[model samples]
Target chain A: MAPEERLIAVGVSHHTAPLEVRERLAVAADSIPTLLTRLRDDGFSNETVLLSTCNRVELYSVPGVRGDANGLARWLAETGGVMGRDVESTIYRLHDQAALHHIFRVVSSLDSVVLGEPEIVGQFKKAYRLSQESNAAGPVMHRVMDRALAVAKKVRTETNIAREAVSVGRAGVELARQVLGSLEGRSALLIGAGDHGKVVARSLLGYGLTEIVVANRTFGNAVNLAQQFKGSAIPLHEVERYFPRVDVVICSTGAGKILIDRDQLAGAVSKRRGRSLVMIDLAVPRNIDPGVNDLGGVYRFDLDDLAQIAGRGKEAREVAAEEAERIVESESERYWRQIMNEVVTQRIGTIVQTADAVRVAELERLRSTLDGLEPDQVAAVDAMTRAIVKKLLHQPLHQVRTWAREGEIESVESLFTAFGTRKEDDV
Target chain B: MGSVLTIASIVTILVPVRARRLAQKNNAPGGIAAHRNWEFVAVGLILLGLLLMGMQSDVLPMLTVQGGLRTLALFVAIGWLVLRRKEKMAAAGMILLPMAAVLLVSSLLEPPHAVATSVGSPFFTTHVALVFLGLGGFALSFALSTLFLIQRRRLKRKQFEDIGQLPSMETLDLLNFRTQCLGFAALTAGVAMGVFLLTQSASGRGLGDITVWGTCAVWFWYAAGLHARVVLGWRGRTAAVFGVVGFGSLGAVLTVVTVVFGGWHGS
Candidate 1:
């Protein structure tokens, strides 16, 4: 047997760890190349892709030698500044087919904290690219990553697994579009120029939002982001002044106090003459007042409210997720079967070479005698000998293919021995 | 052959219901593909039904009650195929497929009379074609309005199940407005042609016929809707409600005039 190279995976996900733990373990996008290089330097795995997102941080690897999971787990602990046992307690280790299945699920977003969220696939792609760039990905990693991505695409095309927006940024955009009908000819005031606020602004812009006003505590950062979208920037204090003029408000500031209170929104509603206003608070401390939703013309959605909508989105994708899982399972099985066939074909190379050598020796011995015959007779003899060689090898080759397909390596070994070819000789 | 069409239409109706249930169960994409396939089959069957109808008659008259209903159903089916090409309009099949099936069944149940009661002139045929085609546009507007209402309600309730699959309220309202505009124009041309044909025939019934007055009333009602929408900038719920009312009235009048009176001009 070709020393069975095992595909392994170890990870700390939202399911196994808290947000703080995930954050501590999260690898920055710029650091991925260095991290992958370091993993190889530390002799953790021969091939690897490190995927780190807000919801999960996972390492998928193909080991150069058997039982390399422990070393990889230790490396993960060191990277996160935690004890080995602490990381081990929270980490999940999967081997072979289980490891492959987990990778497919992760890439497909089936294993995401928010089921069917689309970010994971992009994150996975980035990790694969970084791994390749760092020379951490080899043939095994290439095969697994390629199949994982193909499976993800198949799931997306053949199923409705990612039909809805499960993230707050997108769900907020969806709510705004639903309420206000269209974003065309509509203006939005983003209350913070932070990352989440930028995401929300982008989502709104995708819906043809005509105008955007970006407001942040730091006026320079606000101006920078506003320039990107061809919009104006305002200081944080002027959010209420811009509120009535804008139809949507997306706030993600780090402010401790409520930025838009009920009184502020109620006054804005009157100023706008009861035109609908959509408020989304993506801040951790809740930037918009919850009481603002009670106002007749003001619609408010906090992170929790967005989560509720995302939950509904998740519910609507459950059936499609099931269908996606089946696709992943079948693809993974087919991939493993292909890998096994290649390995078996490699093992049987010497037997085929031996048969070829015998046929060539006999043909060479008869070549001299056939030289006395006509040129056509010599050509005929060559053709007959080639046919004989093919017929002689056909049964054995068929048995080898069938045995490899059935995963019967022992039968293959016995069959080789019966043919007077030892497995060691093939090596 | 007609029975085959009926069976196909029934299957088409059931497919959308299944698609809706699948969407509710969260496999909306699969449901959408299946619904689209069944609708294509329904369109083929409807064309076959028209072929059978043509074989039965010397001329393929779309003005006859049965022909009008089937042709209208065909338009609706084709409309749905076009609309459902957008992901946001995928849910349209659940509403439209069944409406098409109902019209198909209505056409099947009430076959047109073998002998023509009304005068068959080129002008009369053109008028009938225009009028039914206009009605088909009205039917499309009605379906869009219904979708807008459902989408609006879901948004109000914060239910995001169909929100992603449904077009925004603005899109639906705009589509409804455009279709109704076309329908209004066609109806105006159709009614004008009818008046000319009536004068030429000298039927003597003149404006006394219920068909003449009723057609005028229905046309004026839809024309008012178009007027309110375009000139006054009326939209959203107002336009949606007008679409439902205007199309509903046209449907009621057509049903009564065609089935009860048994004549093109209420003879």
Candidate 2:
């Protein structure tokens, strides 16, 4: 690799692409090894890691001799069975420090759809692990990934970016807690076993809810969902029978009509004898009547309400994310400088080694002349020659380091060439 | 010195509110930590103010309205510090701190009243101390109950702007319950003491005085609320409402006795 060559990242994320375009280029975990090998074998990159998550599909790479970002972008589009022109608008290419900043933000979840969701970090680690196992990651990729992980850990510990719940399901759980106080001995009655309801139910279960009664239109589906939570499944008609028993009722069915009305909820409230009940209606057509909110001791929230709560959480995380962004920016600059310094050190070492080889060859040629001197005088002569070489190279090496510090990579490279060092010597 | 320290405490407590607002605007770091550190400073200032008031007073400070207000501010500040340690009751500070500042200012403005005629009696001193302490507890409970109502309203209406700053409704309800219970217990004891003192005294004062009856009415109101909570399992909105009204009546009774009767304790 050229001394000036730096890390680059290219692909589409939720920020740049719509779901349709992203799904077209999404690589599955089982196909990661194959795609990585193809990228290397086809000269798309010398080293690369493909991160494919629901929100983003990215390629982090040290560009190969034959490939630049344009070539990599085209290859990415083709690999996903799409034409280059189809995704050209959605693709983003970042190089050097920008690439480093992007990776750090991504690993820290600063770029997530839900501000500080944690799944992205695990996805990044898995992508990196796959790259390593496939022998696709080189020393530069390894160093970048390692530093990115450390930056992520620092951001998480130093800031409160990930402390709030910004997702809809988690926000529902938060609202439930706000209403019911503690979920330790509380029970929930899930009216539908659909995906959205399942997500909310899972969050409730995670928060120490003791019992979950799943009531679905299909009895077997309800049974399956309830069995997963170690709770009972009740028939759809029996939802009211179990309603007064649970602290929370989650409604997410496809029912077009109101399943529970204000009067029925009032009756249940009377039965509960003053304990507060939370009614979370996650259904699209509105499973629970909106009028139920007017009844005392009943806290009712729909999808919009949960979204509002989640939006507030997003606002809180945004404040914390401002601090996390600063950390990522500073760390990226520091790591970039460290990488440059390593390159400078390697170049300096090569020049000194070349000079030393010449010194040794000349000393062997003058062996007979040195034999006339005593052992102590010969040792002194060797030491004096070594010191002379070091003094002669010191000024130029110092200038190289200065150029490196000033980010004058081309100047540093020219200095290496002026010293009769070849490109292959860098490797 | 005590008045100055109390003023300083109020200023210190407002620092967190300013920091929080600035943080929301500028996306700045350290607001949370600043809030926490300034709360400690405020607590320290209030503590010093209380100590100075105690040292400067000739007799027990609770004998005068000025001294009583200062003592109430001290109790509320101390109670806030303790409750905030365990829950996100920072929103309570928005109500409690300003209330304390008002009490302190009122204390500064009011002239020191003559010491109670029964000041020499240990029983009178104890009764006055208990009443003021009970008032302090009720003051804290009032703030908590108000926050509970606001939070409950926000949750019920789903208007969640800046709602994250308040503790969960459950936490607020629980804290409100505890403070109301504390206030109720103190007031019960203090009322019992007043009854005993009235019976033993030859000053012609009796339990039938309007102020005494008002105090008893306030006591009965709290007694019913607490009974419903413990025995009838009342909680949340009902309990918070009871606390709010209980404190309001207690405040009215004190106001009537001070302004209309022209003396403390129906003199």
Candidate 3:
């Protein structure tokens, strides 16, 4: 009814927009309902759905697009409360088939914060459901989303996209535990309350450690962490006091300098009789010296050093991934073919409706002539005529479908060209 | 079976090596893919080799065939490890493949030799199986421990992100401990079964050995070690130390029983 429509995306993603622009245009989920309503009311979006994740903010729409696709551009500029030129500098516009394929790829987690992550599937489902509820999706958008979701499900179940490495924090705690095996009666001193460091602290606690002490440069952050873990919140000034008692030290402060150098850790471990101290340096410039690893039982894991150890089982997982990709590709192809069939059905209905008028008049005349004819014979004639019409339409419809697979309009144009047709009046 | 195995071995190893080298030379982004294909080759080789060594023993003088099979497997296992040096599974896999190769080959040297006690008993056969299973588990744990140590060393230098391709240290470490615990549990089962077999053999057929007693004692040591590691929170280098000691004792018991006591428990 809306005519066969083309889908398009005009937006910014983490790849296209730098952090500054991405944060600027990042529409919160809570405000999406009102924003979307305002957009549709502005008459630029015949169909609208917004994918607003931390990594990206995409606007999917169906044409007839308003004002040469510049309308959505203006809308984005307005919504972010920025100038059109600034938005244009960072925005990317993908047209028709590319837009549809892009969304499909995104849902598959090909464009994720971490490659092969599982979170994108849940995000895509939530976005689709929200748009559907908002009454912002038309028949075409609904079909595309349903197909995209199916592809996402297929990719996850069929491929190794969901397999994950241990989080960075988990890596820190594991190295510490491996180096100094017994932590049952040991004390762990934690610094920095970054998300990564918190995960490390949690892992250590889970491994059945006795005491955890929190200390951060900002005393409040340390206190908050200590409160959460039900541990001692020592003053930042006394960070060195707790270091000697802690058998394991995990540091992840944002400060540039070494929080605990080789000398500081040596002093602590020596006071404790060189009793197998594990020091984890999670700071960027490195909180602990690389030389500290040479000391007996003083194992230090820095970010750059963990790579060789992680390569072991990666080969096996990569093997499983190939098998998975073949499955997703085949399913995506099948879904695209189905969408083409629906489009063909729309075209066939229009052609048949015009034929129906002539056919009904001819059938009425035949019925009067065949009043003496048997009911079975009359029914056979009706079937024969219907079959003729179907046969006549088959070749053109097949060609149109083949073209639809390439893009929606090629075969239709070819069919129009075949009859030496140029205008709607000619049809 | 022999021909199939030999061909499979060559194809699996040789083709994969060449393919990997080619991929590396090409700077193929599919370098990871080349390594995966190598796994298929490895699986094929191992399965075929194991089957060949198994099927050859039915009619022949099993001892000769068994000894020959063991030697071949041991060599190939080590070779496989060296070839896939970059493979993370290679370390633990190296120990497993060789141990299996040696044990299977030796077991066939005298068919059902475990049951050759003074009196026939199912308990003895069960005990022998339990011992091998435990030993295999321990071997796996040993391999995992080695992997854990290597991973730990890399992590200390802060090279994880730089290497970009390795599995995380946390995962390898966890896998190592879990495997160690598994090995320990199997060893405990081995001890239980051996004690049961010993009592039954003594009461019924009256066969006894100091090595069997020693093996039983080693089992307890491993059981205690595992308990400390799992519950008492013994970790990392400490766990590796225990594994080496426990596995070494088990190895010593095995050597004593095999080389010193040629007395067959033939079924």
- The digit string of per-residue lDDT tens for model 2 on B177-218 reads 888888888888888988888888787776557767887898
lDDT per residue (tens digit) for residues A1-427 in model 1 = 2323367898888689865576567676677788887677666677889987656788998765433776677778778787757667898877767788899889898887567877677778888998988999988889889988999999888898777536656777778887787789999999875456677788889879999998988999899989998999998888878877898998877564578888877777766643567888766446787788777556677655565566775767787888889998988877777876775576567667777788788878987786799989878887887788788878887888898687576676667677666433221
Residues A94-184, candidate 2: write the lDDT tens digits: 8877888899999999887777766567778999999999999998899999999999999988999878637667888988988777789
Error of 2 at A207 (Å): 1.5
- Model 3 chain A: worst 10 consecutive residues (lDDT sum): A418-427
Give the per-residue lDDT of model 3 (tens digit) for A284-310: 435567677776557776543332243
TM-score, cand. 3 vs. native: 0.42
| Leading candidate by TM-score | 2
Fnat values, one per model, are 0.25, 0.70, 0.15
- What is the TM-score of candidate 2? 0.60
Give the TM-score of each candidate: 0.53, 0.60, 0.42
Q: What's the DockQ for every one of the candidates?
A: 0.13, 0.41, 0.07
Where does candidate 1 chain A have its weakest 10-residue lDDT segment?
A418-427
Q: Give the residue spans of candidate 1 off by over 4 A.
A: A1-167, A177-186, A192-199, A202-210, A215-230, A234-247, A251-278, A281-300, A312-427, B1-8, B12-35, B58-60, B114-118, B259-264
Flag the better candidate by lDDT, 2 or 3.
Answer: 2
| Residue A353 C-alpha lDDT in model 3 | 61
Q: What is the C-alpha lDDT of each candidate?
A: 0.76, 0.81, 0.60
